[model samples]
Target: MFAPILMSSGVSIQLQAVDYLILAVYFAFVIGIGFALQRHTRTSDEFFLSGRSLPGWVTGLAFISANLGAQELIGMAASGAQYGIMTAHFYWVGAIPAMVFLGVFMMPMYYGSKARSVPEYLKLRFDERTRAFNSYSFAIMTISSSGISMHVLADLINRLIGWDYTLCLVVTSVIILLYVLKGGLTSAMYTEVLQFFMIVFGIAPLAWIALRDIGGWDGLVAKLTVTKPDALHSWAGTSGTENAMGVEWYGILIGLGFVLSFGYWCTNFAEVQRAMVAKDMGAARRTPIIGAIPKMLFPAVVILPGLVAFALTGDGQGYELPTKDGVPNYNQVLPSMLLHYFPSGMLGLALTALMASFMSGTAANVTAFNTVWTYDIYQSTIGRGKDDAHLLRMGKYATVFGILASMAFAFVAAQYNNILSILQLIFGFVNAPLFATFLLGMFTRRSSSRGAFTGLIIGTFAALLYHGFSHAVENPLGMKGGWLAQLLGQPAAFTLGTELAQTFWLATVAFSVTFLVNLIVSLVTGRDKTDAELSGLVYSLTPKPIETHEPFLLRPAVLGSLVLVVAIFLNWYFW
Candidate 1:
């Protein structure tokens, strides 16, 4: 029988001198970049949006790196192990198309309008109430996301190297705070580019070594098929709800692929802020499309190790998953793989890569948070007549507040086994409604501000109500849902077989309700902004972005189309 690796108050993995040296070098470089960029971030614009001066390639990598945090690394690996190959759908189906759409269709409106942030764009497009609602919701989401990254990194460090979890959290938070507070968004973006490369180089070799040990793809398939026949196929058994993921093709497409994916890539300020900093409209439009290329291939590095670990466990090879309460702690899959496969020098690089990822994510959130709080909330409300100098000062202060707030939320993140599920639930409440509001506001000028604001309120509540009444079969109480059902002394309205399914369906409910309610209210309330006022904000009134001077290959439409084709081919190949 296989035994799980139980957590103890002792160090599990030891580092050699070379490992310590590598780690020291990485920390030095990280802090050095912040000080190097400090001279350029003197103004509010430079501090908040990098002075709109970065190249497409830099912003593009940062765009994806900002997202490759605990969610992509730890949560994805956990999903890969638990749900099998179907987890790739998160990238191949849910992310790529939305990224292409953002590049080809949405960037013109966002970059053309001169809005500093996404919530500010809403203010320009609709009204103050609509922008306020989005700004506060977005602020909450960013803090929560940053906290999740912090929690996961601390947990990994505690598990592998036996550091005190609280110490790990405080130390990492301080490092991120110092860098972001010094150089601002410019610092965050440049370091994100560095982190992107570190993550790729650090983790790719582990996947290669794992595959080699398993005798390659065919060998992995042979082993998994014996225990999980559907693990090797992405969409083979997804037609119904009996699959490993407990989601049907429709749920995967509509809930994750359409609603959740579009909601996030199109509306979230953290990712969009990366593209907004590009030097020109052309570059801005290409940012997400460029990021799509690497995003399509990331599953191999991040997800494959989890699948390999699952296959190796309990096969009499003396490997087992770390366990909590006698259940597999899938969150440790990536760190576990790093500890198992890498030597001292390599382990340092891998750990630095993980640190880079967490920092990248946290910095993105903090920068976006500070911008929205300074411009959208503070400047708009309390500090209406503040000069640029004052606003810039406040932005730095907000950065400090954002990191502290994220630290507080880190403890909240510790309650969940798979961080992705909790994140999706948050997105279901926040992004799902926001996407509906953006869709109506951008595509047509008929959406009234009151209608949009009301829709967001009702839509957010609808998601909460649905989640409260729904439960995953295995996890039926509290964070996973069913609390309201318990309060009502009745069974859950919906019982999903998996936590992933429940979150997906909750997003679907939120989007559907928000869309319908917004449409109806807009029809009733009539147009709030006239055609002249909606110029550059609404798609129909905005001038078509011309790319005749650029090379055909560099055009956003061409690049977006090519990305879609490759995404389709990938889905077909994996199918």
Candidate 2:
């Protein structure tokens, strides 16, 4: 009778024109900063790379903003609602090591190269087809991802502020795009610092209140264990194949580390834009890790309150799952939890934090997409004939275009309920070959142009087919079949066929086959290109200065490993 998220549960925090006015004003200020920075962005270099003058914190904050898209803010909480501590490993175990790897080995190569774009570097080392192929493929993913981002901010705002959902989406998106178009990356970076602070300040109190509401640490744990032991630690306690709790170790190592990290952090143009804008090589070098350090702790800060909500709502349950809306949806963990636990005025603040979390992602994506279209697709392609003045005008226009694209995507993305799952579907096809092609291009001088080109084409296509085919298997009847079907797994979740099947298996198959296919092609083609030519392409970028000592890597590595070990111990202990 008492659903935690029922319509009548709390006083509706009806939004006023003043609310929209305040948000609009903030949007104007962000856009004003961008327009003011146009003077600094006179050349293609400045427009694309912030003229390469950003400092450690500037680039570092933007780097964090780039990765902290709406999918992450909402998805982390969603995963927690279902999975538990095992969910946190996505960052602590997966992203941190990838960050450390980037700082020690990859960052040097990236900054050292002097290449404008990732694909440009590929072209230099391999072939034009490789460069063009990567450029376009990445562009599509970034746009789709960015557009979906707008909906996230809009969705959270609507839920938090109690406004018409469409109105919230429109108002939030229009404001964000205005600033993004105005100053481009400059405004985006500055705002990210404020956004990050806002998110932390907003979320911290709610978490404290939840813990206090349960009485204390002991009370909180005791209450949660009694209410939902499945959410307590392992998140790995799924009874059988349909279990959301049962993430395997092999999947963790590959799914997150090799595929996701390299895909998001390393190859993403949005992420690369952060490094490219850095003031110097030194700033660029350390900023990624500096940025990464806080992100590792994010799940703890963001997901804790949701667990508390589950603890409070149990038995016949206050709110089972969001069945009122649809099937097995997990996106409600934050909004539903906040509404139940936080008081009135504080609810507004919590709402702002969720909006800020989303805006950070929206603003970051808008800035990067503006840079990409202006630099890669538009300036390099369609508007190639224009002068500097014309190109600059066109560049600002590109931001507007990107904003519209994102708005469109947000509307369409509603059909799919799981934001993270949809994103992973896209990543399945593109992320692996992206990691492999770039890695080989940098480290191995023996790799050939034909090999690199063929590898990318073969790998990406294979991954796409793997995803489509696997999904087909997942629902031979169709995906509409709900949790009962999922548990029974008509097609199963992880396997082609089994006690279970997951989306991960196809990704793994795609990754292995593509890599092997590309590797063989590279070797066969290596004979045509002399070793010197290969090495030249590989080392064409200015080499980063090496210090044999890296005391920093040890701590993250140790910390990351400790988290993994403890996770396995807990899963085993609980089982």
Candidate 3:
């Protein structure tokens, strides 16, 4: 059964005994690391936040690795094939600056406050209402995100090797569940660090081999120019909807770059939780900046494969993009490339890497979800006044429940062809409004808790209404939005050219409404917390993080600046 065979989908790669050996060894190592770390997770703190003892580098890799899951692997390649180099905007414009901002500016407060989760920080800075809203919303988002990762992995395995989808999902989830249940967040982070290397080594070769097979960059470019003229240039024709991305400069910058990007990197607990677990404030501050280094370079391996796959199609070699329901299924591009290029030994390694990516992301989500559920939701409410031992026990229970919940959500992910679009829509509803609350909560002491809670509710509703009334021109008036428009018998408020563009605009609207409402409500409600109480949580009230003692190269500011320079250069080069 382990031996690969030809499938009805036309996938022809076959795995040998050596391939099974590689897979067995990888699974052993993953589970072994969890057992080894089991002793360290004796208390709630260790289980949830890794005892806040990890060095910058470990947390840094985990930070990026957690994000380099199905979204980065499958969704990104899909975007690259669909939109070409414009997909790089997700990294260059949407990720880098936010990471730098988190490291250099936000980490000081997040780390210094000693909050266990992002929602906990809201509680410290604002009131219980703000924290409760965020905690519930975040828990839902994390579980949904984890489910998407699970769905992607199961789909890949079933399509590639003819495994039953349900069997794949059960086996993969059990593996992830065992490790996380044994070792907690420490296990997850260490595994993420290992997975990071696996993903790099496993996937990087595909880019190089694909480029070589397509006759290098110049040849690929020439081929794309003949078929998709705008595929090679990042910024060309982006001034209006004439571009392949269906987004203009202002929308890209404000909607994606500023609102959606900052919202996720700065406030999303799954990514920020990795940084918060660092051994000290300095390590925490540098964690995201360090992660930003690899993040900026990831496009070469992740996005390039999609472009190569596109260019290879119709070259009279029988290569074609995988199709579902007579349309190109962009989500299969990366896995399809793996099947097209890798032999038995390399195939197992690459497949292991793909599995690792899914586990890394799923584990990250489960860990974050458990932490929030145990500390923010449970302890703060039903489990209030619980001792450390009780909380620790509850944390373990939360881990089990979180994974089960995620497994249930996997079926929901199957409804979409591109996972990233659904994820962005979710973020638009959750993260976009939450960022506005954080912006007001952290930056200004005058922002009342009432203001934050009120703004969040209104902003989230605004996003729902906006999404309901608008949709991409290509999508029908249904789950993708414009439902309210159809119901009201009015034209869509805005008809964009792509689902991604619609999500970006949705995020922008959410952010704008939340920001404006927060300011308005704060002005009406007046201050709630005193300056002394807000000292560590508020920017101006907090003391500057003194990093002078650290080596210059290791300083967060220095690292962030260097990352920004590299990011700018990449954008310029690609543009």
Candidate 4:
């Protein structure tokens, strides 16, 4: 399975017989575990939410592991090389706070309500219309995101190993489908736990080897001084666009940290659904806190390779990134580094790690999609009063549909040359306003379902307008799409420098508009809920929750606070 294969790039995939054996055994073991758990999924609860029987430690790791997919692995590393250590902002500032917020504040409402999915929570708090809107949007988003994973895997295989793209896609789909169909959410989480370790084992060594090759931390800094002085400093030039990222600290904090971060970690069902499966409220609240630790450190693991690739390529060390049509492929940096450094057996393991990341991400999307589809959409709308066993079957069928939908979207995503751009655009449109809806629903008893529905629709429309106007500058209509830009007139010369900054700005505007719209409309249009009605749903109306009997150190507040302090220290240190 791991025999050497020559590629168009002229480097051999030097995977030996033992390496192939390791991969074969790995796949078989994963499938065996899935089959072993097949009987546990007879009920909808088991099939969709792992019977809500997972411990914090297990669910916590799986929580972060599910997110360590192609986007995190590929896009983050590429950004590290392109934008430098400032990319760490995505984790340290952007993720940790929202994650802690989810664990400490939000999980209570989510888990206490015993809602089957995120959309269901909205339905309970708002109305069925709100729930349907969210569920439908999320279903489309999950399949699209999963398809991007499939497209990424096929593209990488074809480019790196001279494999047939369609064949690779079929193989990957079959593997993911089998385990997911057999074991449901339980199996997906179990495999995610395993994939988490594989990601560490796969990428940590590459960082070590690359750093050693460059001499050490000191050596890396010294070499980067000549090749990329800007990349060496994370925050020094972030105040303006004079450095690698060209994004201001205000943009980084408000745009990335508060808006985009909260939007994703708090509202995105693919992530929130993981915590919803915890055995109890305590475990559910602790899940993201536990997940936050590894999330904060992963930048060092994945980004280091990208930084190293930059150093090697800059130094003419035959580590140049692959190109298509004379444009350099930054996404290939990690794989290129793996090929440049690892040999034979190690190479195979690294490859397996990449594949593991892809599958883990894809599985999470598929599982989340199926759960929401079955409980939120199918059962609530089409198959009401269904038995548990029947719902379980529906969940299985939804999984297959999710996978197939993703496969179809993968082909659509392939037509676009820039996957990251499209991904960010989707996130901006869907997540930014969704967060606004949830924030109002949870914090204030006055925000009615009408307000939420209106806010979501208008907020998403605002995001689309921003995106349209931003790109409209190049259109023949010019600022016609955005009369405001036309009123100010176009600049003679300028550059935003990166798509991220643009997306950040767009999401920020959308979020602000949505929050205000929700607030004003909610205040004017409806009666507020009584404290009795708002008990566990609204923050101010709810009583302080009783503490769990777990040890002080293991307690959610203690751990979450500690994680926050560590995150603060990292920002300070990096700054």
Candidate 5:
């Protein structure tokens, strides 16, 4: 049988002096960039959006890096081990299309309108109430999400190095605070580009070593066919629960591929904010397209490690999930793989890459929250008529607050059994409703502020109800066992599994309800927005801008098409 992951197994690898040297060099270089850019971040716009002067390459790398948080690093690998290769769909299906759509269609309105933040765009298109609702909720979500990443970092360190979790949290938080306070978003983006390169170099070696040890892709597949038959197939048997992932084709296609995917890539400010900082319209539009290229291929590095682990551990090959008090800890797959495969020096680089992932994600959220708070909430309402310098001061202060608040949330996440489930529910509640509101506001001129706000409220309520229904069956929680069951006309035994499948369906239901409600309310309210008000904000009233100086290869149409073609091929090849 395979050994458990605890250090008691005597399998833990030790780091060499050279490994610590590499980590020291990386930290020095990253922090050095922050100090170098401190001069340029004197103004609010430069502090928050890099003075809107970043090249497509820099913004594009950072755009994807910001989203590759603890969840992407740890969760994707764990999913690959547990749910098999189908987890790759999160990239090829759930990300590529929406990214392409954003680049080719949505960037025109978002970048051309010159809105400093996503909530600002809502204010321009809708009303004050709409903007406030989005701004406040988004701020809270970003801080909470950032804290969870900090917690993940601490937990990983505790597992791998036997360090105190509290110490790990403090060390990581201080590093993030130092760079963000000095350089703002400008420093964050530059460092994110550097992290992106480091992450590839760090993980790619593990993947190569693992594949070689297992003989190769075909050999790994042959082994999995015996140990984990369903793990090798992506879409072959996804129509029902016969596959490793219990989701159906409709669930994958409509629930995930459409609702969840579009909701995240299109509406989430963390990713969109990177594109917003581009030097020009062409650069902004090309950001996601450039991101999509690397994004489509990253599964090979992150996801493959999980598969390698599963194959190696299963049927008594090597290391296995650690059992703490008789329950298996599956989340340690990636770290455990590094310990098993890499030696002393290389292990430090891999761990540093992991640290970079969490830090990049946390910084992105902090910067985004600060921007929204400084511009949308504080400036628009309380600090009206403030000078740019005054607003810049407020933004820096908000960044500090954001980092502190996130650290607090990281402690709170430790109280939960499965923090990712809570995060997913938050996404369902926020992104689904928010996307529905944005969709109606952008595509149609008739959507009223009152109607959009109503849809948002109803959509959120619908998501909560669905999540309650799904969980009530598995674990009874007061009303979910009694009142909620009666309301749904189903018994507590009718519970659904609270996985990606449930989250996707809940988001889908919320989107549908919000879209219908918005449509009905807008039609009844009649056209409230004049063409002048809708200029570059609404689809029909906006005229396409000419960008003839741009090369044909870099055009949104060409890049988006290439992205789609590659996505299609990946899905088919895996099928």
Candidate 6:
């Protein structure tokens, strides 16, 4: 079923039986972690946050593992095939700044305030409505994202077992749910160490194969330079008319790179939950930067395979490949590549790589989602008087519910088969406003609950509208003689559908309008909450805090500044 991609230029895939056995053992190992860790589960906090017991390095590595999803290995590289280094702006511009900002500014406040969930912080800073709005919206987004994860994971597994893709999703989701249901973060974090290594091991062989195919690093670069010059050279993509709302291509840079970056890193509950669950102030403070080290190199591992495939395509060797309806299905490229290049034992290993991503992502969500529900929803709302066991039970129930719903959604998503589009739609509706509300809540004490809720509804609708109109415009462009079709022509086609920038813009506009609305409502209602009243929740910078105002000489603040400068230099030099 999945053999075509392995038949690369000349390499022969080997190891038919042993590889699959090792792969089965790998799955058994992860499941065993879940059951083994089950004995330690006692309370919601222990289950959901690994008892806040992880060291800085463990949490840091786990954090990186969680963030680098299965799609990232393929998706970003797929983007690189088309957009070059520009897509990495999601990392460079968005990720680096967010890491620094979190370390210097956000982490201190979150950890110091001792808030359990980011929305709990919001409630402290704003109002109950703010908490409720953010919580519900975040829950929906995360669950839907889980569905996509299920689809990808299921597809990867199906490639090996010849099972129905939707069935694969259901099985994988059930396994994750059991572990998550049993021990939550303990299972996730402890097992993340295993899943993380599996991914690296799987990629190791493929990278070797890629280099071998091109005859070594120098030869690969030289051949690639001639064939995919633009793919390697520029950090920026060309701008032209016929983008969404007639906006130029430059909008992608501004919207996806800048606006969306702030939202996801600063506000998203899935990522923020990690910081909240950190073992101590030190771990919370250092884990993100620790994670960033591997993350910086992640693109080289995750994206290079697709680039290899893209390179192969240009060489007259790949013309036979289908393009998922001619839209350059980056998601499928990894599977296709695996089928073509991996030897038998290596094939099991490559399949495991995909499992690593799927498991890591879903596990991260299961833990994070449970945290939000426990601290934000259940503790504060339903089952408020429940005992620790009850809360722990509820969290497990939440994990089950989360997985079951996502499996159903995954099945639906597979039938539709538009992972990126569904992802943008889901995030566009959820992320932009959450980003706006959180930023406002963090920076402005005057921000009211009314403001946050108002912002939430407004931001969500704006994204929907943006997606709606953008889709409308895109339909004509997909036609034979539309502006986009004519301009981009064949192969290097500027897909109107997946331009991430347009989605970001839609979210941004919605965010801006809703933010303005929140401000006006706050001002008009004049229901004020002073910073003094909210001190414990909002502005609780460390008692031993290094003054953000007075620049530190040898401080983390100083190191952060140094890092940003170096990142900027790298981008420019490489751009």
Root-mean-square deviation of Cα positions for candidate 4 versus the true structure, in angstroms: 3.2
Clashes of 5: 2
Show model 5 residue runs off by greater than 4 Å: 1-5, 8-13, 319-328, 472-494
For model 3 the local lDDT of residue 275 reads 96
Candidates by lDDT, descending order: 3, 1, 5, 4, 6, 2
Across 94-175, the per-residue lDDT of candidate 6 in tens digits comes to 5777776776677777777777778888887777877887788788777777777877777655654556776677667777
**For model 4, what is the alpha-carbon lDDT of residue 483?**
38
For model 3 the TM-score comes to 0.97
TM-score of each: 0.97, 0.84, 0.97, 0.94, 0.95, 0.86
Global fold similarity of model 5 (TM-score): 0.95
lDDT tens digits, residue span 125-193, model 2: 777677778777776777778767777766666655556777876777776766665555676777787
Specify the poorest-scoring 10-residue window by lDDT in model 4: 472-481
Residue-level lDDT for 28 in candidate 3: 90
Tell me the alpha-carbon RMSD of every candidate: 2.3, 5.0, 1.8, 3.2, 2.7, 5.5
Prediction 2 global C-alpha lDDT: 0.64
Local distance difference test values of all predictions, in order: 0.89, 0.64, 0.89, 0.83, 0.84, 0.66
Error of 6 at 484 (Å): 22
lDDT of 4 by residue, 499-553 (tens): 6777787789789888888888888898445668767777776565577678787
The pairs that clash in candidate 4 are none
- As for lDDT, the candidate ahead, 4 or 6, is 4
For candidate 1, the lDDT comes to 0.89
